[model samples]
Target: MTQYTQKVNETTLKMPVALLQVGMFVCRLDRPWLGTPFLMQGFLIDNRETLQSVRALCSHVFVDPNKSLIQLRSPRERRRSRRETPEPPTLSPTVDRDMARLGLREVLPTYTRTLKGVKQALREVGRGHPLNPERLAGQVDECINALIDNIPAMTWLSRVKSHDDYTYEHAMHVSLLCMVFGIHCGWPRHEVRQAGLAGLLFDLGKLRIPKALLGKPTPLAETEWQLFREHPKWTRYLLEKSGFEQDVVMACYYHHERPDGRGYPVRKLGTQVPLAARLIHILDAFDAMISYRPYAQQRTVYEAIRVLYHGRNSQFDAALVDQFIELMGVYPMGTLVELSSGEVAVVIGQNHDARLLPKVAIIRDRNKNPVAEHVVNLKQLRDAEGKARFRVKSMLLDGSYGVYMQEYTRHLVLDASPA
Candidate 1:
């Protein structure tokens, strides 16, 4: 009898084309088999024609030893084989707190650029032209890169939104937050970009909604309400017609769906919902809550966050709700807060390591009078006695204590909104 290498349990081996034999059972082709004319689950290379067909399409193939009718290697070669060591995957740890904050600040100019481009794209699309997919893609790349570098500056800029620019800024804010949220969820770079693009376009259908309906102070009538409910499907159709990818299309379509199956259109429930859609839904609601819309009084950042927490299981995904709360924090940026020092300040940024002790810009003094506004990073402040100074007393609602928000944030680094 012909000598054969001792067989063990089923094992896969990468074999060169020259070594293939009639009894070898092919497992996988190096290239896509569907692209080739040959169609089979896998073939037993029992003849020269079969071997020739495979070699024509692939430089090498995977073979199963157990499936092969004949043994592949001699006993000496089998005994000599040793397992190859696979290199461990390289992991990158997120930057330290201070560095990350600095990184966020450094990307503001990039954000300004992307924001300008996005606003223009939206305008064109609202005018009935399809958004240039390439342009939107470039902005998404810039956004993802900025968020990956450091979250502070972008986080800070997101809060600098002006009520006057609410229409233009809402999309930009959602897009930025989506990238940040995606990174928090440990998504890969490309996936983060996908989230960003989806977010920027999630409200595209609303652009087509008559401004009169959107701006009505009273509740929307049933006809107007029906139009609002239909926006998600409209957005999905527009995106599909515009050649948007499946991820973006589905995210836009299902974003308004509720976790409790009460949401508009599809009414998808829980994990059945697309992750992108769920994330955009949470962020969309958050932005709308905090925005100074013509119809609704702007809710304080604290108040909006409270609402999100309250609706977690029914209106939003519970895990994502927790993650977002931790990400945005109870005292997130733009929150107008009073310090134990009797100072009134607007939250400017967060100290990642010390979330409760965020950086704030002192807009008013203990007497509630406007002062020479300056930033006080809570983590760095200390009393004359060398003890940490300044804890948040309570977050005041927007407009409760009035001051010019634009002027306070208008540092040398900030100028007019990008053209």
Candidate 2:
């Protein structure tokens, strides 16, 4: 695939024809000047008159370097020369009517409530009688479906009140992240739901540990470590007591197991670890790396992903690592990046074919001046030769830019406008 750079609003004009828009983001333009096509290295700063004139002459206006002004043939001519063509889908009134029958907004709150209930159930697990494992599973299934259906529309995390309930909240976040990976992998709906449930409950073992140990900022001593090793077994007992399916209980018990047999508990290796368990292990590690612990600051998503990628064969399953990389992109969600053009933006989504050139929304310039209200689709713009205009030179952590991602996430979801 073609590699492109990201640019901000800054544009550099190359004499008469070329315009180069460079910053944290970059775009190049080569268009005809006077009578011949010219190449520029910037955004269109003075094309209002030219754009209007070209629009009058053709249905679509494209820049040409060799010619000053060329009249292109109509769409009919292009259609006639096609080697192969797929027919456009026919839209019917019945299809539109059927779509109208679906109620989307009615489902969002229901799913959100279900997530809350799942968290409650997980929290209640070892406190008294065992919680309902089947109900928790059902809640997870609902949340996954809701998330998949809303992914395209969800530009940022929702503004729910911050809960001191760490275990349940963390479980929910991990499940959501795993679901994102699952969607990227094109997993079937059923499989994705199962993965989400596994992710949510992967840390059930932690609940069996003493509250003091769970909250400790210091490293565990030998005796404490010995107790830590048994948490998985305790977790399995808890699940079995709650009447969970064997597979679900195993998924929770073995989530920490590694492919290299280097992980905790049984130290099972490779195929001995179930697929659900393996995926949960990777997701669990990723969530831990990016999340703040009492002893350490959180790492950026990009940094955590890099650590995971580098440790693929040893620390994680190689194939699952590759799939996760593809799922999250080079700059995963919550990553702050500086573009080659010198503008800074947060990566909100992945561009699969262009890992290095995912879509970014510009927020700051080279001088760190705020330009908070802009959104740029880096994949849509091209150069004079119809080539991608910008490239991503490096990825930066949000902390380096004086941005706290969790705080930012809070503001993004709560504030009505982009800040």
lDDT of each: 0.75, 0.60
User: What would the per-residue lDDT of candidate 2 be over residues 54-73, giving only the tens digit for each residue?
Assistant: 32332222322223232322
Per-model TM-score, in order, reads: 0.70, 0.67
Each candidate's number of clashing pairs is 2, 27
- Model 1, residue pairs in steric clash: 104-153, 105-153
Per-residue lDDT for 298-389 in model 1, tens only?
87778888899899899888888889888887687667899998899877667654577887777789999888756677866655533458
Which regions of candidate 2 fall more than 4 Å away from where they truly are? 1-115, 152-166, 183-190, 381-390, 396-419
Error of 1 at 362 (Å): 2.3
Give the backbone clash total of model 2.
27
